[model samples]
Target: MSQLPKASLKLFPCTIGGEINYSIPEGVKMEILECRNFIVENERTARRFLKALDRNFPLEETQMSLLNKHSREQEIPLMLKALEQGNDVGILSESGCPAVGDPGALVVAMAHKKGYQVKPFTGPSSFLLALMASGLNGQQFAFHGYLPVQENEKIKSLKYLENESKAKNQTQLFMETPYRNIKFLAFILKTLNPSTFLCVASNLSCEDEYVRTMTVQDWRKTELPDIHKKPTVFLLQS
Candidate 1:
């Protein structure tokens, strides 16, 4: 009699800041060969990543389902069908680790509830990378994900986070859309206390990676980096 396959949900992390030349472990490549079903943020980018990992990856045979901010809650369960059939299912985010700040968390949570084993691969996380180099209190840090887009609300949120950091001596981390990087930096400089420390990590792990920590007052005097339309993480501590 043939042995039954052991089903598992694998979470694979990709390179951050859109740099694809970064190295992927041989073990991860070997594991990718075992999974024929993938839940990804973008089918095209996932296919490209797999192809980049291995030029001869079996793209035609593999199946990919979309899972992003717009994906419906009802459609998530369907993505796990392959696991029920005793096949390993993989989750891929557009960049960095899946389910960290991505929509893949929903499926991972469901997998756990349904009693499927979840295997996460080691990879770079932009936020953690920023914190490590930010020269701030790493022991106590919180990731706020993103700040408000509106001017008044955004300023209000910044003040609140700065106050919280001061009260707890904790590091507060946040990010903004690539296109709004410059404007957001300006807001941070203008709103936060001059004595507060701020760190801006941009295009992490890429060839043009930039990570700098400085006081809000110092930041005002120094020339700004060309972070426009580039991925960046901001850290502030008062």
Candidate 2:
């Protein structure tokens, strides 16, 4: 009997919100050069990221596939076809680590089910960075991707999260679209209790990185930082 060949699925983490060359590790760059097939959230950014990782990268010879919110469930398995062919496949998100708060999770799950080796590389993660700087209860925390968009629904959800945090002493973390960050912060400040502590981490790992923790009352008193149209993470603890 002939032995079957094996290939690994590599999960590469890009910069959370900083210069790729400054943030990406040399090991990750070397591993990226080893794989020619990649499943990315955005092909354009992934290409740019690869190019930034190494100017000598052979982009023309690489195979790039999209796996984002618009990706269908049926199309995911096909994305892993490269792995079955004894070729290592890489996964990259628009920013930060793939699969965490990103759609790459779907393919990662499928990769595991197919018995392929799934390897994750270390890199910047906005939520984790925020949590570390939050001065909140790191031991007890939960990440709720996003809240409802509707005003009433969002307010209800905020109140619920605040109550849950107070009861469990867990830090609650979430995010919003860059463009809506200002509005979201305003809403959070207005909705959460005055005594509740809120931490806003913006432009993480970047030149303009900002991370501040304060009570809702203190935040109200101080002038808001210019987080408009910037990637940010919001954390609350009561």
Which candidate ranks first by lDDT, i.e. highest?
Answer: 2
Residue 129: error of model 1 in Å? 1.0
Which digits, one per residue and each the tens of the lDDT, describe model 2 over residues 71-185? 9989988899988778899999999899999899999889889889999998889999999999999999999998888889898989999999999999999988889998899
The lDDT for every candidate, in the order shown, is 0.89, 0.91
TM-score of each: 0.95, 0.96
Evaluate model 2: give its TM-score.
0.96
Show where candidate 2 strays beyond 4 Å.
1-5
Candidate achieving the largest TM-score: 2
Task: State candidate 1's TM-score.
Answer: 0.95
What's the C-alpha lDDT at position 210 in model 1? 96
State the local distance difference test value for candidate 1. 0.89
At residue 220, candidate 1 shows an lDDT of 100
Off by over 4 Å in 1: 1-3, 18-23
- Give per-residue CA lDDT, model 1, range 116-136, as digits (tens): 999999777899889998899
Global local distance difference test of model 2: 0.91
Looking at candidate 1, the ten consecutive residues that score lowest on lDDT are 17-26
